[model samples]
Target: MSAATVSSVPIPSRGWRNDMVAALFWLLTVVGVLMMTGAWFLLALASLEEGTEQPKALAAGTTMAGTTLWLGIVPLVFAHIAGFALCLVATTGRFDRARGVLWAGEAVIGASLIGLAVVLVLSGGQLLYTPPDYVP
Candidate 1:
């Protein structure tokens, strides 16, 4: 084929499957980050002094956050991590045009995990700040 003819031919992009997988990965990542933030807020609420009065809405939100964190977010995060690992394995030696998007998702997950750890530590410190004799 002539160079002009070859150059004129459309180049095939990555398959729809890759795009779909990447989209799902990113959606899960966003959900995970939002959940982590909610969990961190719950931790902050839980660390509040027992005697401190909180608004009814704040109290209700805390309960909801705790429930969702335990029942939804935790499981989802675990599954997401597993899915990411599987994707890495499955894509081995394959040409992925969306590889950069996957890498960015990985970075987001790593950063969120680190932030969650920090929130946990800070909450722990706050919880432990009360005196032994302190009572609600």
Candidate 2:
């Protein structure tokens, strides 16, 4: 057959879910960076200020926001990591079944991560600094 006689081949397209997961991956990564930067700035400002009202609030707020942001995106990252691990396993095992199980595990991990974040926020946990009630 000549080059001119060749026909075009069909291209495979990804599903909406795959597209959504990709978007979330990029979005979460960017958000995580921004959140961390803002948290650092707030914590620094809180340290620089010599006050009981604004500085204390800044420290607490940054701690909560930063922790929540980090916790929220961690499972999404693990999900991707798990997906890669499954890909390695798929070299020998049943890809379809393994992918389903890995995705389900990711979902559970994501849900639990969210719940943990909510609990942390509600509990008003602090980090990088000590509470006033501390003896040290």
Candidate 3:
């Protein structure tokens, strides 16, 4: 092909790439929302059993579950918000393979934050528990 013919051919736009990135971000948002809702449901179930006469082990387990879910709530919300911001930035910037990398990093950060929160909650809950033989 001659240089003039090649020059006349229009270049493909990157709009579709941006749209795909946006769709992926939306999917991530939806998943995050579902996870948050499930955690809330579990927390509610634990609260409902709070008044029941349960064994020490069962009660402690419920308490830890509730605490961990509660701790995770904030981080989950924050992660969603931050992820949305990053998604906007990625889609609007230069179109390249880097958008995929940004999405992966955002996902990892969100997951790690939630995981860390749960671990801290469990550890702190253990410290708050009293032994059967312990006096006031």
Model 3: per-residue Cα lDDT over 1-136, one tens digit each: 8898779777655443556657766576556545544444444344434323235547567433454345445555565566656655555533554665565566645654564456446555332233355356
Give candidates' CA RMSD values in order: 9.0, 12.9, 9.1
Better of 1 and 3 by TM-score: 1
Write model 2 residue lDDT over 2-89, tens digit each, in one string: 8656856643332323554445544554444444444433443343342234446576774333442354345445544554443333
**Model 1, stretches more than 4 Å misplaced?**
1-17, 49-136
Deviation in Å, model 2, residue 37 alpha carbon: 0.5
**Alpha-carbon shift of residue 23 in model 1 (angstroms):** 0.3
What is the lDDT for 61 in model 2? 79
TM-score between candidate 1 and the true structure: 0.36
State the number of backbone clashes in model 3.
0
Worst 10 residues of 1 by lDDT: 46-55
lDDT of each: 0.53, 0.43, 0.51
> How many clashes does the backbone of model 2 have?
0
lDDT tens digits by residue: candidate 1, 1-136: 7798768767555543466655665565565566555555454554353224334447667532244445445655665565465445444323564674476457456646754776667666452224356457
